[model samples]
Target: MSTNRELLFKYRKEGISDAVIYFALEECNGFDHLLLSQNLDKDIKDENRFVDAMNHYINGEMIEYVFNKAYFLSKHFYVDNNVLIPRQETEQLVLNSAKLIREMFGDKPIKIADVCTGSGAIGISIADVFKNNKVVLTDISNEALSVAKKNGEGLNNVSYLQGDMLEPLIKNDEKLDVILCNPPYIEDIKTIDEKTWKQEPHLALIAMPCTLFYEKVLKDFRRIMNEKYLLAFEIGEDMEEALTKLVKQYCEDAEFYFEKDMYDKTRFLYIKSANSYTNN
Candidate 1:
């Protein structure tokens, strides 16, 4: 059994980032940051598992997938290749949705849906924060939904439905106060990096013309939406023009706008019921 300090020195020589190495070590060894700092001479119990994780990382697997965990909105989510790993930009979408939810309906009990919820990250985060609200997580893939179910284990306010986007809601005659989505919006798989294209699930990444899913959602927006509602989407950076056109065509009476991410890329689309806009 090698001491933690010796294991760290050996892996650090592999040129991996200190953050990545530390994260892998802590997760594999069940060591918190304080434990890691205070007990460098402690023996690593599962050195082989740590080595395997490092090998996966070195072979272009994202650390999130290698560890089967992703952090979104300060919550840890279980993830696998079956689901798309949550991204930082998606975290922004969650933040924006929460902010708008509070702004539009403070302390009002509401129903929220995370359409195409991959790991249930967005909906689970919202449900965790807004205990008064009901959250529905819908996904098309059973395998993906299984991963989401694991991530949502402790939340009493969340329900998981397996179906195509919005179909479950429509079938159930469910009307929601807020609808948040981060659907697959990639225009061309070839454009994505080799590692992502090869490793990430394509069903969660690629869509023909990139705006197809958005159009599908917008075309049927009113069918499953409450009279006063908000719909938010995490869109591809290049999708503003096409999505703006779709929203205008399908939701002419709605108030909608495109928002930029921290990088100043047009990465979010928001549409609100006309009455909601007037009330706010």
Candidate 2:
């Protein structure tokens, strides 16, 4: 005997966003005008699912995880605790990476890899956008790879590999024109909100030395890089100076570019050697 307004109020009281509450309600029960109308407060019939969903939300479970699917670039991607939830900021990563791919490689065939490809959101979304590119999605966790594979189903241009970063690519003798990664760049897990930290996979969120994985990618995986390689990362906002030093140590000649997110945080890094590609 719960009215829609009551349910909405309940969710808002628990600090859930109106959009997320709406999404949860819609997923639980199809939207009805009476449900959203202030004047027509009536008990919702058979809203057990809605009640359960609300409980989950109130308990700090991410709405996307509750739904088991997330919308990325207008596509639905399967997700769970095995992977990190896709964020709007990462959509920017996809958009810019797609633009760069088109600019550097044209419409011709190209090889790319998505490292730390949780839920296959980045690699799958990229492949869906750039049809001519063959993308290999790599994750160290088998469970994460399984989740990614489910999201990547029916995408013929995508392949899955289970190894840390570019290790699978190196073993397969694959050289890529681009390598994109949303690595674990969090220097301290304690800094994150308890609610979110409880729900997301810790391995996908925290890195011991923060730049440990990034450093490994630049140093050990240099063999699998193509002539006109583009290396991009969704970086921690404060990693510019540290990453700059690492880039100098491992890839001193590569041109480095940093991109700010909508909040003006330094959120991305683009490293490439245009001169090598142009000369060749």
Worst 10-residue lDDT window for candidate 1 reads 271-280
TM-scores for every predicted model: 0.93, 0.90
Q: Write the per-residue lDDT of candidate 1 for residues 108-220, one digit (tens) a residue.
A: 89999999998988999999999999999999999999998999998899998999888888998997889999999888766899878787888999888788888878878
* Candidate 2: pairs in clash: none
Please write out the lDDT profile of model 2 over residues 1-280, one tens digit for every residue: 7776688897788788888877766666555334545332556544798788778877778889988978788887888888888888999999998888777777778889999999888999898988878999999999999999998888899999998777788899997888999999887877998867888898898887999999989996579987678888999989999999998898877888899999999999988865734633
What does each candidate score in C-alpha RMSD? Answer: 1.9, 3.1
Report the number of the highest-TM-score candidate: 1
